[model samples]
Target: MSMTLALRRSIQTTPEQTATVFHGRRQSFCRFGDRVARLASALRTQGMGSGDRVGMLGVNSDRWLEVMMGVWWGGGVLNPVNTRWSGPEIVYSLDDSDTGILLVDDHFLHQVEGIRTTARRPPLLIHVGEQAVPEGMLSLEALMAASAPMDDAHRAGSDLACILYTGGTTGFPKGVMHSHGTLWAIGIQRLAQTPMPGGSVALHVAPLFHMGGMGRALVQFIAGETHVLLSSFDAREVMQTIERERVSDLLLVPTMLQALITHPEFDCFDLSSLRRMVYGTSPIAEAVLERALDLLPHVAFTHSYGLTELGSATTNPPHNHGAQGRASGLSRSAGRANAGLAVKVVNGDGVELPRGEVGELVVAGPNLMLGYWNKPQETAQALRGGWLYTGDGAHMDGDGYVFIVDRLKDMIVSGGENVYSAEVENVIARHPGVMSCAVIGVPHPQWGEAVHAVVVRKPGAALEAPDLHAHCKAFIAGYKCPKSIEFREALPLSAAGKVLKRELRAPHWAGQSRQVG
Candidate 1:
């Protein structure tokens, strides 16, 4: 079934149940479904036809969900603009994808003039906020209220669903194309792994533009769960919302989770109502994970590992977490493959590697993306032999647990010896003074490249390179340890909480032609 039918089923099963919660406003499934249907009719009358791209640029809100459902219900494709991107990046995506209808809230309406001027063909603007509409934009509420409800387009199975742009941490973002069936299968797969609780209330704090957040929303919607959305990530708001709304299921990246547990007022909020917590984007810091486990003992912590092209590859379940499971090292893994997906580690030649061998991770599944939008060469290079070649460097254990090492491009080759940055970062993270750390290769005169580290010290804690060197030597070879260390108050992180190592390496190789050894 298509994503649209999933929402239809939810309304049929529980029409009067709470469907969305934003601020103090709430909507039931029956009302929400009618709005979605009306939204489809509204857009169809406004020139959005089958397969047309409709873009949304806003933070997480109930309106965002309406726009998502409305687009699919109208048989239109979604182009979720990254809220963190600059004007030019946004323009490039809209131009490249040929998006014709754009929706924005009060927060992003200010950028409309810039987008209108930069894009090759300006999109029809639809303002979704409660404030008065801008001069050139139509009001979403007006359209929904005036239009009549229409039937679902029933677009399913291989129909284009979304065009999500990558984080562009390394370079320009590529449009990853996902089909209705692909997204549907992903949501179903997540439910197959763990069933949703009856009348569950889910909290959405992550940005809807990212796959991690949108993927979670999709699964929750399919499971017929009530959604409680926040405008943005605020540690205090997250805590208060959980206590106020009795939110049962929530998704956060590891960094966000760490921030939440470490918030100054964390202990004041009664967050005992939380039942499940999902985290991804990057591997969890051992110290952070332990602290989270101690603070939220009743919450089930799950780790998901996947990319924009591949949906829901692996999930570390709650049973493999906590103090006992952490000792078993299973908590550090990316978990085994989910049902209906095949995951493997393969060498450069595309041969599958034996267990415990570090190699490029590959996934073969129906949930894989159709291809990159308008970039056939890049698409062919990424998708080969019926497998999506994920650039992650990982090794699987005898029990089939995947342990990510580093990005294949991020592996540091110092003096001809390859060093996985994640390996070094893990050791540094164990230091009592360290809050977070990222390792990258910087140009070296003699060694060609040297292992360098950028670290953030915990509040009121002091750490030195020599002490860090001693710690690393205890666990790994001296060659793998950082040759030089730089301390930073903070490091650049993507919206998904992943450390932007490419940003860290850019300055060091600014004048150099070669990047790798």
Candidate 2:
């Protein structure tokens, strides 16, 4: 079934149930459904047609969820702009996808002017700000109030649903296309693995733009549970919100969890309502996990492993967690293949490797994405012979558990966010003072891994770390900028003259059990 129809069930069966709670502003399913319908009607009036792209650039809120369903209900494709991306990067996605309409919250409204100037086709803007509507934009609240609720477009299964952009190897971003069926399958499969609590209060602290947050939201919606949302992740606010809302289920990255559990006031809050915590985006450190387990003994921690191309591929179930499971080394595994999906570690030639041998992890199932949008060659290369070649080096145990050894792709995940070294290198290479650069993820105490850059300065150039860091931030998101930088005379290079990132990463990662953090 399609996401639109799935949402309809909640509205029809539990219309009076609390659908969304954002900073104490709660809305019933009936009201939420009406707003979604009216928003859909308004989108259609603004020239959104079947499969037209509608970009949403905002923080996590009830309105964000409303716009997501509203876009699909109006028979449009969703393009959730990365909240961390700079204006130019955001503009590139809008232009690349040919988006005609955009939804912006008060937090990101400042970037609209820059996006409008750079984009090929300036989008029709809808301001979702808490304050009054800004100049040169339509107010989302006004549009919903003025428009009449319309019938659903009945778009389901195989219909173009979302175009989620991911960092590319060639300095640009690639849009990963997913159908309604793909997303729905992912949510349903996850539910099969670990069911949500009855009348669960699911908290939404992760950015709604990311697949992790949106995917979790999808599952919560299907279960017809209440969604408590915060605009963004703040350690203090998260603890406070959990106490006030009595949040039962939570989706967070390891970094966010670290921040929350380590906060000085963490123990002061009555977080007894928390029953489930789903974490992913990067591997959590053993120490961090142990500390979390000790602090919240009642909460079941589940680790998920997946990519934008394949949603919810593997999940380390809660039973394999805690002190007992950690001692057995079961906590290191990425878990067995998810429900109804086939996962195998295969060699470069596409042959399945032995269970204990590390190889490229490939996944095949209905949950896989359609492909990279408009990039046929890249799509074909990624989806070879019906298997999605996940660029992750992994091995399966006799028990069917998968353990990721290294990243086949030069990617780094820091603070629970994917940071492509190539993308960062591209920005660094542009600096006039930089002769050469190699970016890698290094072991970090707090963030799990920090973006570390090794740069070779030009002859007679006196470049500092702060200089390069600021330069990168001017183009990409701040999180992508190198947290630590080293000026090297020259980087380790292979016989082919390629920078040997593995050698660069070795000293920092020595003694670590897994190559990845």
The C-alpha lDDT values of all candidates are: 0.85, 0.90
> Candidate 2, residues 1-517: lDDT per residue as tens digits?
7898878998999999999998779899999999999999999988999999999999999999999999999999999999999888999899989999999999998897898788899999999968888889999888888899999998889998999999887778999999999989988998888797688999999888888989989999888889999998899998888899899999888888889889999879999999999888886887778889889999998988999888789989999996778899988788888999999999989999988999999999999899998888889989988899989999999989999898999888887788889999999999999999999989887677889999999999989988997899899998899999998899998999999998999999999755342
Clash count of each predicted structure: 0, 0
For model 1, how does the per-residue alpha-carbon lDDT over 95-116 read when each residue is reduced to its tens digit? 9899999999999988899998
Cα-based lDDT at residue 255, candidate 1? 57
Q: Give the TM-score of candidate 1.
A: 0.81
- If scored against the real structure, what TM-score would every candidate get? 0.81, 0.98
Candidate 1, lDDT over the whole model: 0.85
Pairs that collide, model 1: none
